[model samples]
Target: MAACQTEKEEINFPKTDLSNMPMIPKPLKTIPTGSAFGLDAGTAIYTSTTDPAFEKVGRFLSENIKSKTGLELGVNSSSEAKLERLIYINQSDSVDLETPESYQLYIKKDSILLNAKTAAGAFRGIQTLQQLIPTKSNDTLTDHPLWVIPSGKITDAPKYGYRSSMLDVARHFFTVDEVKKYIDALAYYKFNTLHLHLSDDQGWRIEIKSWPKLTEVGGASEVGGGEGGFYTQEEYKDIVAYAADRHITVVPEIDMPGHTNSASLSYPFLHYAGAETPRVRTDMKVGYSSFDAQKDTVYSFLDDVIGEIAAISPGPYFHIGGDESHVTKKSDYILFVEKVEKIVQKHNKRMVGWDEIAQADIDSKSIVQLWNSADNALKAADNGSKLIVSPAKKAYLDMKYDSISEFGLHWAGYIPVDVGYNWDPETYVEGISKENILGIEAPLWSETISNGTELEYLAFPRIIGYAELGWSPSDHLDWEDYKVRLAAQVPYLEAMQINYYPSKLVDWNKE
Candidate 1:
């Protein structure tokens, strides 16, 4: 994982078909050594008897398959007879395989079997099965489609426990259904975490029953000076459920201390007289408005907000955004973050914040999201805080892929698809080793993205890059081989109607 193993020796993937197939986020291990498995009218899926949890997984896969192939593939428990043209899933009691997400898949001529320790691992295997479906003519998925796939044995598990993606909705609000679309796409790439940036200077996107004005006033405008919207408690709960059903955890973020213009405008008591008069910012400027950290009422307001957010979001980690606070005094910033951490802990939620939290008296058990210097990340890791590496230079999907790009910013430099795919999370920083690392995250700040189409255009291809980096082993990553597989994914993406920026580095016609 050292700088993606120096591009001179790019990694390779399993050699099976020279035809169309989605290739990014290569599995941990794959070997094509058996006869082809045909997905036809007779295919059936089976679940584990020991764990009834897989019944849901079986139904999910069966529905997707039915939609794509127009085949009513049967789904039954292990008690049923093992039939030909089958996809089998079972739980293993083996002790050496400690990770719950670890799984082994064997695709043979007549039967494809997947074995995992838990239902979660089995669900990850289902993602791979979808990828195995042919990409060519993917738009015309039918019973007669070429359902043949090369027989292979794949032993796979994620390299990082917290493979994540962040969506900044406050800068440009997205509806609940749109957010669900984003979650489904990321989950397909093996990303397990969904960090929702729900608050910023432009908008506040979640309801607070105690403070009804937060959404009524603060959620009334976005960055472009348009009417904004906020999610009701029930809507937010549905989002959480949708994400959990797909094996993705929702990490709701309430950017506080800084990025509080919307809040200050709603509740004037949170206003600092020294700062600019509170107003919803239409421009993408940072570090201006801040909460009155010293005011006891401000803490009381945050207490209510945090309690409400934590109640809806069942995820263990609650993200208290503590980044970019230029207007707030250093002492005030520290005190603000310190109080936020205690509030989060009191609600029985683990705290997560930007790397700047390392500068304050933050909780050691909290997870620090690194978006700036490696020195800051190393410092946080050295102090016993887990690190979520998302250096803006390489990991920021919001950055344009090149200078000529029509969408996204270039402050982090143009992250070409190769540049995005080549940097490994494990070795991106010199001093912060895997032990210090909690996982990897790619943040898509929606400064330029206003809709799901724009978000997909910025995310794809690069998002898949981060997905592979977090799942595939360090030694297994190779840019040269990966580029080929990466190009192959174009057809599948097109079939799904994903609006992706086609990089010149890739030969799309090759697929």
Candidate 2:
């Protein structure tokens, strides 16, 4: 596919003045049109079959059409009835789809039907439909503002299954509402996974009923000391629910052994010697305090904490952070891995840890989020452990955009938006197969980020690129084309009232 294609050839819609303006330009040929099943201009009816979930999707479509074009869309859930212009969703089709920008829309003149194997697919289709809506004044272009149902077939699926982005809530706390907003934005861009780094030396975000001090005392900190706040169980639940509705899985990370300052402060017994400790420093850095993995009590405590998190999180995976554990005594690290593996199995959830955890004789069921280097990723892949490539040199968004910026931290290399977009995951680890590759994730560490605005400034434009790299086929990604699409997305961000650094304005040559 060429880098660009005209919209008229792809989808037949009345060309309006606004259509030529490039604000809503035609999709690139590489951008698969989910309309593979076929579509017709005639009105279509939709109905649900054995699966009631289809009925919910139908209702959502009806509501969206009503709001966007003031058109009343009819919906029926009966399986026996044959209706023209209709759709059927059965129980057998409830599979998950995690594409970056592909949707499945089935339509015919007599009836139109659409079914997403998963809610994520359904949401992506909705976003595509939104793009089809005319951006110009409805009254000037036509008598009715309703969009013409473009004819075509779309049987689309994502190239990657793990389209994700990681957020560091520990360094700088964001409000529950702000977290929801980020979820909405991620979902809007077709990213399916939201990795929340909930714990670090800086702070512990989630509430633990048994260990109340984890939140009560660890949640808030002194003003100037860089101590931040934490989220209550109620607030965390609310955020999870909100993400669920948007078809985005919330993967919570509780860094262990190393990033356990907050955990130690809350439950002194979790420390190496079971010595009581007060609230720790807010500086975002590697933690020295670690749980005594050799101790049985430590595993019990982890089981309890994981149990609390699992109860609230509906996702199938749990992140038992095993990264940067400098305090791990050689024997203790091995025992810790053994115990953690058992606990992960007990919970019936796959364990995900940083690449460093691979050294602890962990099970293959564990998924490794490779950060330090490709060597770790290769080792994990060789051991049959799935890996999410997030090498710090290329995928870490927390690094300053340039070396000149005095963002407080100097250790992490400066990386700009272009540098992030230029990173190709397939090439990151030489021998790793794409099948073994789970997906790509951009980690926004919060050493210098103090608040939500700073977080947005660093995450936005770069995140969009990562989303594309994770979603689109590697051969199809074009930096120039992405910049075009990214330019169009800026206004949407503005309308949404987000503070993100503009990629176009950032002078990559300055360094």
Candidate 3:
């Protein structure tokens, strides 16, 4: 194995300026305190509150420290940590906080205090804390010794409330462990949402007890005619719980009307009579199969499927993919979306669909994700529906890095690292301003990629840039300065064993 591939292998610690540590999604404010804190075996972590969530945050920090350095720090459930060197996690009762994910980190010579209004805030702050600890230590203890963190104060919060990363598990089924691994990477960058595209033409990736055949038959085949898999309710819940622990919400998507070949194949009644007998689609072609919008049985089937999925999904939104219905008549397509939106709401989940859903009379409370058309986005804004901006050219992670890229499609055009990082979400679309937006999401449609290595290659570096756009202030964005900080993130990526693309845009800190 290459030396850089192993986390324990010693590497040169870059001569970084402490004040400007390479932190992604740069904090809202950072001020150097001209001091440093030494974290050693004697250090203990104390929590101000008895809440289990707060305690979990404390454990998370200690566990990460133990993993990176051979130091097993103690965690104590106490209100105070006196004289002895310690790290404190506190939940504040302040009402002046910007958002639920906001937190303040104060590092002094003797102690470190992380304060936040909620446990989620504390969890987010812990990410910053992890970033502060250098990948390599100073002493000759195999480059892993007592860690020193530069003293500083950081007041941080995401500019947008709904930063998300969408994974298309339908085209390619990712195992629960694989999904958890992706969630870990998202948490490291402080992303709060993981949108799982659960169903598509190629496969149905989630189980519905009422519709057993949905998984038994529809889930049997994937994009390349491989034996696909599905996640049982228990496994699906496991993913949700794991994400929640990391302060990330999992949003489930079940595409309908157009991307329903799998569903139609499972139950022919769901397929339109005019189309050929529904068959397993191993190709990437879309907009060919659709649900019979006129049938009352279709709505009943959807209600049962939506209810089963919604009961397990604690998140507030459910995605009914409303894009690419070329064969369905315009009127039928609009009516189908209107009915499905009601079904989503019947289960207490706000409807979220692709930009095409804007053509329907969707509820003002629903959300429209901008993927292709600006007119559709503007129409959504006009209807008072908030938007999740994921313009294909800028935020699509599955787009090829260049013409020679081995994996991914380029219909949306190649999204080089710099092109992906340079666009501003707040001003990307003219009609949809910040008020109409609910943050941004980078959708990775798994057409050419299958395993974790290919998935990580397309997601990293670019997705890192998306995380920054979602969290940091819009006016403060700078590609030049940001690239330097991004370069410093190489160690963390390597340590995590992520097969990330080494973009030439940044001078990586590989010393």
Candidate 4:
């Protein structure tokens, strides 16, 4: 193991004066600004898109723009506006945008053009455009005169195809509204995937129609014994659709075999230690309980659970929680994993599991999400399976920044922002390069995040680093420069009313 890999890298807030303009997960390359285009009521969002979905995206963007600026920017296909203050969000024929998420934005004195090859790209560009639209005041639903974008050009695409953030909703059940807020925040940071940890030992979040008791009994209470809530099938669908509209694929995780206490509680015969009645766990210990790997009925239960979640989840991947199976025998663990893998495959979804699953007999195409060291990551990648590098020490948002920090765990090293952004996912391990890397993910295991403010406090600045690592190109990555850029976002974060922790390492005092 490399000495520096484990050693905590210190933060060096850049020496030079950096731009105060906020661009979280900054664009690849932006040129000098010219004249600015101020948005007004007459401005129209012009797009020749026939697809209702893309048109809906335009409407969504228009609505948000209108909300920020108090300008009713109508979505018009007929390009006949008098002033020509047009926001063109269209699929371009001129530029060869090879990636679905690639976009080019050109801001001129009169009009702004955002072009891409696909709706996904256009949506990403909208996120960038939103960042460019300054908040003139801290008041919500108030008009902002500075809802203007400086004249510049930005060609942006993610460095890794799958930039993800996982929210462990089961540990602390967040409402649908809360989840949407999280999705919007993730979209702002340009993250493309929201891996929803819908199931855990404490509770089951999504309504599984085939398994009614899973929610009726298992979802009734959360970790601290609050009346837990579960997203109904319709509500879950709404979340999937909402995420899709924002160009974020929702990867739902229904962890089984180990995080199966909730499941076992719902159906007592499902078997952890051969069938004793169980209750939803109120504690935080792992591997003390799991599904009966020996039972054929347990396999049937998996089929039902996996089938329901897979049916609702439109994304390609389904995450099976295959971590910390300390209680199950090694053979049983491997057996259970193999059975679950087949069930996922039967539903036409690719398998995703924690690094522990790499030890099981899984298909080469399955994705392994790593929260520990690189050993399992390297092992899985070597076998042709891709790895999402979310090492707990680096990417787990729940870990406290330093000893003085109030809200998170210290097990994963104190990850200040620089430590979060310093490591390159592609070069983290010896053998793992860009090819073996699927993307990078920052996971917030919600043991401590009980409310929206707490969640934001732990997630921001650090999660911003996750976005930068996944989006910004290798050459553009510099922690010193990034800390400055990150510090630049304080006003933006403040204006948005997001309760982010102002790091002691950076100067947040107004210049």
Candidate 5:
């Protein structure tokens, strides 16, 4: 055990003025060495009297240090009055030391304490620390680089609690390793939520113990194009663990009440009786096969499926996809809502559905992901449901960033990087208050994206812009400033060999 220091030391840094920016703080004089890894490798020392949330921070540091530094770390909590090399989270204080929504990192000699008023802030602080830790390439710096902690403190919290990015693994399945890489990328950008569209008309991407055919048969494809396979239960679990380690929640979406072609193909009864056995539709557009939401068997089957998925995902929300259920009889929509509500309540989980699902007489607790228009978000909020704004006109990343017709699906107008960066959700809905907005999401529907590289190409640059929109205050995000920051991020992405869409060349000097 390391001896604890018992004195308060006044800390000071050079007050040299650099950029006159009010927000940017002067760099700290000293930098802390060593790294904290995954959850199990503890770092922070606290008293048993420490808040549970503070303990959570310690667990996070331990886990993070092991994963990032490949070193095991331990935490010791004490009531002794001392100043040490580590950060000390003073839970006794009511004022928040760091922003709850964005990332923060603090460093001190011998010990460091990552403190946040809220659990989310603690999580974000750890994320920033992960970014600060030197990777293999950064280990050989010429000057002993100081871990300059950003000053002027941010009382930061998320603009939207549900800043999400949805990945369509059903269109073209990504391997577990590829999925883990994607999770890492999302974490880097401060996107806390990852929606895995695991099942669709094309294929079922998870194994079901009760229904082996769902994976054994539906996971395979007869059509050679867009033909990829499902992940085994073990692989899916590993992916979940990986995302958990990154503090990113994985919300598995099983398209139902529609988009059940794959599941229907596995079991004929899942669809309307005597309907033709569903097959993979090669057309990129959404297909119509849906589970008979009115059937008792349908509810039973879904309960089993959702139970399996919920067991693996630690997220509090589940996506019971209710989009484009063309075959859902008017009566079935009502019944579908009832059945979904029962399942969600039974599992102690919240449900999230596309805007159309709002039509069903569902509980207000279900989150509405407004995709078609801002009006949908307004309506959802008015109806007392939380909202995630992902309007097709502005936030949809699947749309091409340029006028190149060859790029995007082309239903909505092409939206380039600047267009994405320029979108203001606060202004999109005229009378609705921003308080109703739970957060923003940029969906990457994989109808056209067939491989990891294509997925990367379409996702980045645009995704970065979305992250800023989600994290930074709306007034703080400027197109010119964002472009500058974005340019710096390109080399980092390249160093990681990330495939991404190139931003259109712009002459910023003229502006």
Candidate 6:
């Protein structure tokens, strides 16, 4: 039997309308053509240029298509002739796009064209295209004769350049493969940044070669007193490379002053004199342990740590966890932050810290992440530092869906799916406007969750809406319309086997 019908053959496509297709973080503009594109074995993916960037995305599209529909679509880079039933990926020569991640997608009965100014843009466009593929035909094991994509034209770009998700690996170390899986989920939602909370009171998840004891002693235990783990330098690089291939930047964070029990346990010198000698902590309590802010050696130690991590990390920013220094005096805390800022600058990376860092005289190029304090956020804006808003009530993933939910905390109160999506970052704090904002980040602190399933349960559904909040324009967001779009994502999530919360607020679709 023939795998696909020829151009001369008559193949009737099902009537399709994409006017209200469930696309998270809806595109800036969409026009449904009331037609559809049918995929078969004969379709080929074509790259318009020889650039590896375009080729990479082309191959990615082909691979994803094959995985979903049991179709063998070959990627052709040398093709110059127009081809029927082809997916053409191109890098446009335009400098006027809103951001480097901007893209345009046009789909017709015979072909799909994707145009972007950069590879990141092409990657995002492909994600939107993936959403257009009907879930009924998305089976890899079974031989599916046909797959369909709704015909449409979409022009899209993110409202914020830094749509990020933070994974806290310090409290409970997640393996590289586990982290990569998290990265895949982030990329599928068009998130561009993965902020790794690498160190905290419970554990240290990255190896420091100069100070072997840091990981040897500090990384040995986790929140439940279980034998924890750490990633070697080579392993860290591999994770970074994997994320880069998906167009996501890896932002490494090492919390300091406070959240230093794991570090101080490895070296006694880090603790203040006459203070209780820090021991390994498995409990969830915070703001107890702190680095010796009065010591010059503490600054010298940070120089080596920052230099080593920055050398391997290619990203432009370094996050120093500057929150929760309850034990340290306010004056000393401010001085510690100021000195650490210089050390971070010396490593050629812009400094990033929690909102408390605003108390220090830091550089304007630095970024302040707002987690619990709006006053600190306002202070950061006053100091001219950019802010990444992750308000606890709205963006904290570890917050339980409700009192009955399993595997999450309730200190920040229950953050149901709707609550996570209904807030605005630009005006969340009065003094912090659009100009002083970098973007929004949903931080998944791993205090309660231990494995991938638990992580997915807490992150999905809500994270999907967070992605929309970060990408879609503020004026265009409507809760009623978005819940429907989010409900449409049920099939994709089910197909991917993501263990998402079945929130009662959304009337999810059945597969």
> Which candidate tops lDDT?
3
- In order of TM-score, best first, we have 6, 3, 1, 4, 2, 5
Task: Return the TM-score for candidate 6, rounded to 2 decimals.
Answer: 0.95
Q: Write the per-residue lDDT of candidate 1 for residues 1-511, one digit (tens) a residue.
A: 2442242133121245412345446777777774466676656898886677787788888887776667677788444332446788888876734588888888876678988888888888888887886543222333244466667787788888999999998999999988998887887778899999999999999999999999999999897787888998999999999999988899999997888999999999998776788976889999888888899998888889999999988889999998988788989988888988999999999999998888886667999998996777887887899999899999999999887887899987889999988876767788888998889999999999899999998998789889998888888788888877887776567766788888888777543
RMSD of each: 7.4, 6.8, 5.8, 9.3, 6.5, 3.0
Displacement of residue 492 (Cα, Å) in model 2 is 2.0
User: With candidate 4 superimposed using the best TM-score fit, by how many Å does residue 282's alpha carbon deviate from the native?
Assistant: 1.0
lDDT measured at residue 309 in model 6 versus the true structure, 0 to 100: 97
Query: Each model's number of backbone clashes?
Result: 4, 21, 0, 0, 31, 0
The reply for model 2, stretches above 4 Å from the true place, is 1-49, 59-103, 106-115, 146-155, 222-227, 273-279, 403-410, 505-511
Q: Which ten residues in a row have the lowest lDDT in candidate 1?
A: 4-13
Q: Candidate 6 on 1-511: residue-level lDDT in tens?
A: 1323354145555577776788888988898888778777657788766588889998888888877776767788455232447788888876646689999898987788998988999999999998887655633422446677888889898999999999999989898988898898889899999999999998988989888899999999899988989999999999999999999999999998888999999988999653456888899889888899899888888898999999999999999999888888888899999999999999999999999999888999999999989999988898888999999988999999999998899898999998998899998988778898999999999999888889999998899989998999898789999999999888778777889999999999875
RMSD of 2: 6.8
On a 0 to 100 scale, what is the lDDT of residue 207 in model 4? 85
lDDT-best of 3 and 4: 3
- TM-score for every candidate vs. truth? 0.92, 0.82, 0.94, 0.90, 0.79, 0.95
Ranking of all predicted structures according to lDDT, beginning with the best and ending with the worst: 3, 6, 1, 4, 5, 2
**Model 4 TM:** 0.90
Q: lDDT (CA) for every model shown?
A: 0.83, 0.67, 0.88, 0.80, 0.67, 0.87
For residues 331-413, what per-residue lDDT tens digits would candidate 2 score against the true structure? Answer: 77767877887887787788888887777677887899989857778788888998988888878877877765435243657
